[model samples]
Target: MNTLRIQTRDGRRTDISADTLATLTATLRGRLLTEDAPGYDAARRIWNGMIDRKPALIARCLGASDVVAAVNFAREHELLFSIRGAGHNIAGTAVADGGLMIDLIEMQGIRVDPEARRVWVQPGTTWADVDRETQLHGLVVPGGIVSTTGVSGFTLGGGFGWLTRKWGYTVDLLRSVELVTPDGQFLNVTAESHPDLFWALCGGGGNFGVVTGYEFDAKPLGPTVMAGIVFYSFERAVDLLRHFREITGNAPNELACLFAVRTAPAAPFIPEEQHGKLIVGIAMNYAGPLDDAMRYVDQIRNFDAEPIVDLIRPQQFMEHQKFLDAGQPYGRNYYWKSDFFDRIDDELIDVAVDHWAQITSPLSSSLIMHLGGAGQARPLDSTAVGFRNTEFVFNMQSAWDGDAGSEEHIGWARAMFDAVHPYSGGSSYINFQTEDEGDERVRQSYPAEIYERLVEVKDRYDPTNMFCFNKNIQPSAAVLRRQRADTSPVSD
Candidate 1:
């Protein structure tokens, strides 16, 4: 093969000569895929159907060393590059157009130290992998409702889930990270060793570098827990929400719940008459003892005005983690808008219902994730993830099948987001950022002091802005100028 042409970091044409490419390929244990290589297309596919980026090359990294080599290659050539774990990220930023993609899907390895109560995982590992291992030891790591979501992106972007109320955000439980810096050096970062890098990596997307491994402090919980759902007609949504507000005001930390307004799916549990009809659902998971969690089941049912179906029962924790899988399957076009609130009062409730009435597709949903307890007990500055005071995290999620008429679905989601924006905390969630959201949205997501600190870290590790595909935090102008001044003239 001739020299492989590619785009550089500065958006210009470049080439990795055949010999260079062969040498690079030999240095790694994994395959280096070019545009025409077998499995290249499949390797580039992500969970979101909307993103259709075709990278110039794909690095199918099988392990940590492969990631290191790929990072080094991209840096040495100044090639524009991206990193992919499970490719389940909502924004689909893992694959870049005409750039190098470091695919880590083959690196999905997990190790649990039941004695030490810690779990070490590779970036490509999904939450289900961790849950399966940890739950076997009668313990759990706080993760998302969907089992298939990748652990690295979620944790790095400040994850929240059923156990979030008890164990705090996923970043809170993170003990250390094994990252390959922009310069292609392996670093074992922790609070005690590389505090600055550690702090930034906690919730700071993949802005600094590519993380190969993550270690988190696991919590002892369950192989089984009390978890279920309650359904009600859309007419009673307001009433149910009002009652929910009262419960959330004083609900126990062990109990985590989510309130969603959407058209009910035609599941056997749902009455055939109510299929495809609008309804309000409360998805609850009680990590505490079944005997104790039993008391709150009826209490939750009472919140609904005219209860339609109550599937609340005790089931395996793993099954509970997989509950939302049906609602969010692969290959769906997904656009999300999100915000946090100190409370979910009538004003927000009305706006949510009003928007739910405009849902363009049956797959779309309006949801409010109840957040409190340990996630809020800690101070805001303690971690890179902010929004400590938020009691409810609201999301307008739009998902649909096929490409035809997708524009209108996206427009509907954006409109609903606009209506609910005024009631928000004037900030956005980094994880929920869509491709349309710009740099300003990124800056406002963090506090002034925090954003500046993140900039400082960016300057120190990735001064040239190599990792700009994510929710990027650009290096300050002063740092760029300093680098220029520090540069020595070459006169060999």
Candidate 2:
């Protein structure tokens, strides 16, 4: 009489027999855990604290085969399911209420081929794991700044990081990805093989299937590079912002900088008195010659506006990758509203600082990131990550603790985005958006033609749209037509 209560995507309830569950668990090389099992609560948790969902069961996948088995089991049961890679997605997509969850945390394995400048990465691995291994050969795979973010989601969602100016988004370097589609079939997709699916995976999030591994065309980089931070008083916020623009405007491809208006945290480098004070500064990393890297930030380094503290210097590649980790601790409620920018003019600066002035939570901050260089050189058709022409990106990143004050924090982020919406180019980064933004924003972020193409690919691989989560892309018109044709009354 050991039955599991489960909910389907259509909001129907069903019970799974203990015998059926045992059979599925036996098929997997991995173990299956029920809600009452040890570690089930922890396994169901994700990065964003606001997401507190409990799946009825967790299938902790050990390898690609385990993923395939889990997918088939869930599909057979018609159980609502979610795929958890690193469990770092801000949308809390890793788990759904009373559903089945395929957890990939146990599958972190990385193989680096330095000579070929390629790396084979399993989905559960993080950027930190890749950097630790890739840096051993003086090679780098362009990844997100937060080292904890999983490789699969970030790369598939168009990853951009400190090295983007010098190299490109992580997807640009992708050679192939191994995925288990909604049909429970494992297919290795690349630009040459299954080009359409490959295109969709470049930035389409998790609509088509569950990705198991990725093969990347990694680039040679540094074990040590010139990278660091500088903090300035908010009194000179405008001047500091102006300097930031000038520095990144015509900057060399080897330099990538991030400017922000944040309340100074109590770090050793920041003065005790300045802690909690509104401030502005730029965090920079140089992927070029060490000497040139030194000369790169010299202007701002010696500016008359004066930096309250400057820590820019040559450091290990690893240090800069996780530079912002402190501010983005796990279990904190997080919300981010983002936009694309053609330039950072005076008006935009004023708008950003105004929002910064009204920030209710000390953890909330505004980020202006420089875009372009080698990444811009790539053709628009090279991948699905459109809007490569933009010169900048705006992010109003908000983080607040506990539920009591969540509204106040999210309100600040939304208001800030609205104030600067007119300045935006009518597009945004999909990965930075919250789940509430929904399908419309997902469709609007890409060109109409590009989005339609994504739908077509979704139609081809997952006609029923089983993977309908995480900034989902619905199946195209053709898929609906075929489904109707198959189900319609037929004459003899």
Candidate 3:
């Protein structure tokens, strides 16, 4: 490794030249901390507790130039490199062991253009920041359900939230992205120019490159919207869930809802007795006129079952994002498995009910999001986001105690996913994918033609397979042959 001629933020490597260190320092307006630095340990922390990788250098990138410099430095030495946008990925690819991490946490700039109904954002900024800024102009970007999720990663991996059923995924609204390629070049990619790269980044995860900033088309939204949770007993969960699915599919675009089976928490709204009980709750976000939203949701609210709690009402969209935020805290280990369903059938409902009975941790919850309407209208070729044909996204999460209970929770999730997979559209949301699995799984996530196009784009940008950490698609010569054959058919 001594002959590697590596670059270091500090004096860890004796082979690094003084000139290279000086150039690196000039690139970062902020501090570049090495492994031996005072805050090195704290800076490397990520959302998932299971990931404990330690990077050699944590460059707190001040601007795009810093990112470019970091990429080159890592490439020059052949050292492993990783990009940290929001570091909220459950897969924990943001931080790699003994590699370089280009931390973008300092780049939290957001500018809203109300007249144009668009917003420019830095990768470091979160959904909460976007909402807070855009709400000043009565606008919003369709983002992740959690406000704290980073725009860079969330948008890259296909963001779906309260506004998803209404406005489609976040990538649908992206107008442009400013990114630094793995080869140390800065480019502005969009529909008109470098369209392939732009398409790959949409749902390509972080495989293509590090996106420094994004320009998004914002939509008119609410500072206050009708949203909250409506709880039902476990015994009636199947009936309630079936009805919930139907209502959500037929409901107005403004009305977005997710059904969850979780251990009831000791919140003030729930009765003291119901605390710790297995319960099914329909969480909702209605983005249109409150009266109309209420009218649309009345069918579910008016159900005959005596409800334990009805906390649904008009509140700030920001508040709605924060409602479940407290429940999902940092440090508890998380393992997730997801299935995309074309329709919610009775067989699937039975599987859900069977698993709902065995949920051991209060943090463990299963989520079923309604997908369709505006979701399916987006052209398959518009972005690399997969599972466009599916109408529902289901996640089986198991957040348990220590390593001892790992097998139990994981088994349950796998079993539940397997049982209902027959109804799945042979695809899943890439963001929620835990195991890298294989190329076939990734291919299944997207339509066949779109997957091949993405492979071509990946070959163009990352030919050497440097950014193969995420759901990777290595472009083979065979793929090129087919592409050429398709384009070069008989011209007589």
TM-scores for every candidate against the unseen true structure: 0.97, 0.97, 0.91
Indicate whether candidate 1 or candidate 3 has the larger lDDT. 1
Superposed model 1: Cα runs more than 4 Å off: 484-492
Residues 252-370, candidate 2: write the lDDT tens digits: 99999989778898988788999999888888989988988877879658567668888898889898888888888888999888999888878988987877888888988778888
Window of ten residues with lowest summed lDDT in model 2: 299-308
The TM-score obtained by model 1 is 0.97
lDDT of 3 at 338: 89
lDDT, candidate 3, 297-335, per-residue tens = 687687778888988889988889888766566666778
User: What are the per-model numbers of colliding residue pairs?
Assistant: 0, 0, 0
Least accurate 10 contiguous residues by lDDT in model 1: 298-307
Q: How much is 466 displaced in model 1, in angstroms?
A: 1.2
Give the backbone clash total of model 2.
0
lDDT of 1 by residue, 1-492 (tens): 579998887789797799999998898899999988999888889989889999998999988799889998998898988889889977888988999999898898899999999999998899999999999999899999899999988988889999989879999999999989988889999999999999998777899888999999999887879997888999887888887787677789998888878788988988999999998988899978899998777678776266778878889999989988888888788988888888776898888787788888889887788888899889887778867667888888888998876888888888988887887876567888888888998988888877888898999998988898888889988877787778857667
Cα deviation at 145, candidate 1, in Å, is: 1.2
RMSD, every candidate, angstroms: 1.8, 1.7, 5.5
The Cα local distance difference test for each model comes to 0.87, 0.86, 0.80
